[model samples]
Target: MTNSTLAQLLDPAITPRLVVKVGSALLVGKDGEPRREWLTALVAELAAARARGQDVIVVSSGAIALGARRLGLAKGGRGSLADAQAAAAVGQIALAGLWAELLAGHGLTAAQVLLTLDDLEERRRWLNVTATLGTLLARGAVPVINENDTVATEEIRFGDNDRLAARVGQAAGASAVLLLSDIDGLYDRDPRLPGATRIPVVRRVTPEIRAMATGGSSSGLGSGGMTSKLQAAEIAGLAGMALAIIDGQPVAPVGEALASGRGTLFMARPRKGARKAWLGGKLRVRGSVHVDEGAAAALARGSSLLAAGVTRVEGSFVRGDAVSVVGPGGDVLGRGLCEYDAGECARLIGRHSREHEEILGYAPRSALVHRDQLVLI
Candidate 1:
């Protein structure tokens, strides 16, 4: 990005569509209850965004913390992962209820969208999940998302909502992702050190800046720390979205960031559109196909997935499904919707598109996947 254009990123006139991930640590009080005022303040800022006609989604954590208090397990950590899952089971109700009530206070409705990583990694499910979030925002509803912890097995990951919030930002095509945490901003060292300083802005994510990060807990009852917040910033930045790790202690911190830009900002990397970003990055595949160097170069130059260059098909997939396209050396070039079934794909292998009917009785389309339907990895 042009160095002269940094100020434009901070302009409120841009009226960003945003995703705010509220850390569990920010919502807990000294007494360890959910801080009503802090939540209310966060809600008010989100409401302000809504008032300005910008969309907002809350990828919130705090269900276990809240449930621990309610279930009389506040001081206990002896439970197995299943035990914590059960605690989250109980806490999720309160989590949604409290968020819903707070939104209702602002005359807005909170629609809960609970998901597992399966929802994000599976191609069919990913599209549906984005559709759900999109519809909620379009209809003027604030979708408060949470991991379906009750059914999730991989609790240690994405449970922090750092990556989830990043995915949500990418999905929503958010202009910025605000990670509300206890710490005000990024520090050069642990905040406890005498000479440790707060870094107000991050122009680039250098390894030294990354080395400064250390682990922090979530609400004293959940997982996530300063390290995860920085990780979230990296994720958001990759999706062409700035990330603000602002103080979640003050009720008005969100407003403060809005008014004066008082937070650590990790600028976006000038991303492609949301769908392309999602398609290009992830979705674990059953197998892959290897292409020639010419195909690889063309793909690197932004060409779409096609038939002729595919030297081998690795997995069985139906037509119109997501598949990985790789170089013969085993580097993935991109992913795209397949035009032919795996059976047809094998027959059409290394053949030009115009040779379709001669080899196969019929063809779905001339192109294996249209440019718009393909995303370079």
Candidate 2:
């Protein structure tokens, strides 16, 4: 793999859609309040990036830490889920207020977006999120996103903002993702060790690279460790977005990281279209639709999967859930977001588009899977 620098990635010629992840360690002070001066500097950097025609989205983590301090909860311990949820409910207001005030100073409006795991997991929900964020960006508003801790259960929680930031970058089709943390970059071993060395760039996240993560958090206020950051990098790579992990303790950390090229940069692959990216990476297929050779050939020729082409439907899946499209001999052709649920699809198989309304009593869509939603293997 070739080594790369942040300076090369942040070229002025390339105006990027940037997703910035700020951890609680850099956002909250010892007194449980926002670190106003540091945040102000960061806002200045963001404003400069905007001036250069870059669109910025921030994924911030500080609500739970600030709330814990407000509620007199002891530090460095995973408290009860109820208490954590309660703290998030209170702390979110403070977090939003601080961000709004900071961005407003530069004449930029900040919009709060609280999301749960389901928001990214469900196809319909994911589309809604992408549209909302797109509209906000077009209107020159900065979207401050965070997990909805208030309603999120352990089963649905993202656990850390690093992975959430990666998902946000993927969903938003961002060109780059910046992870600001206490440590500057990834190291071959813990930096405290005598012979440890920093890895400047990563082209691919192999098993050896994952093994380098020691899962150590630098601050008590943040939940993510190096392991989580590596996981985030892998996600970003798959989404075709470059990711950088840099030290956030300094004033104008984003600017400094770009200027000095002192961060671990994970190179992204060639980007896929939005539908293809989501279909290939983020989805969990709930069912399979097997089609005959004619249907498979049509799909290969970039045609939509029609009800007339489907031979059988397997497993239970709801409308808009991702489902596998398989060939007659069980070879997986691709995946797509289905227009009809399993029951509807089963009844419509081998029927013509003109017969859909008569067979199902209502024809919401003619194709079982549209070409726009299909991603070939």
Best by TM-score: 2
Error at 135, model 2, angstroms: 0.4
Estimate, for each residue in 1-377, the C-alpha lDDT of model 2 and write its tens digit: 12366864454355378898999989998778889899999999888877778899999999887787777876522478888887888888999999999999999999999999889887789899999999999999999999999999987878899989989988887888899999999999888899989899889777788888878786878889999898788768767888899999999998887777788999886677876777755535799999999999999999999989999999999898889999998877888899999999999999999998988897559589999988765
List TM-scores for all candidates, in order: 0.72, 0.76
The list of candidate 1 runs beyond 4 A from truth reads 1-13, 30-32, 74-78, 155-157, 258-261, 279-377
On lDDT, the leading prediction is 2
- Per-residue lDDT for 182-208 in model 1, tens only? 777788988888998888778656668
For every candidate in turn, the CA RMSD to the true structure comes to 5.5, 6.1
Error of 2 at 304 (Å): 16
lDDT of each: 0.74, 0.85
Q: In model 1, how large is the Cα lDDT of residue 337? A: 74
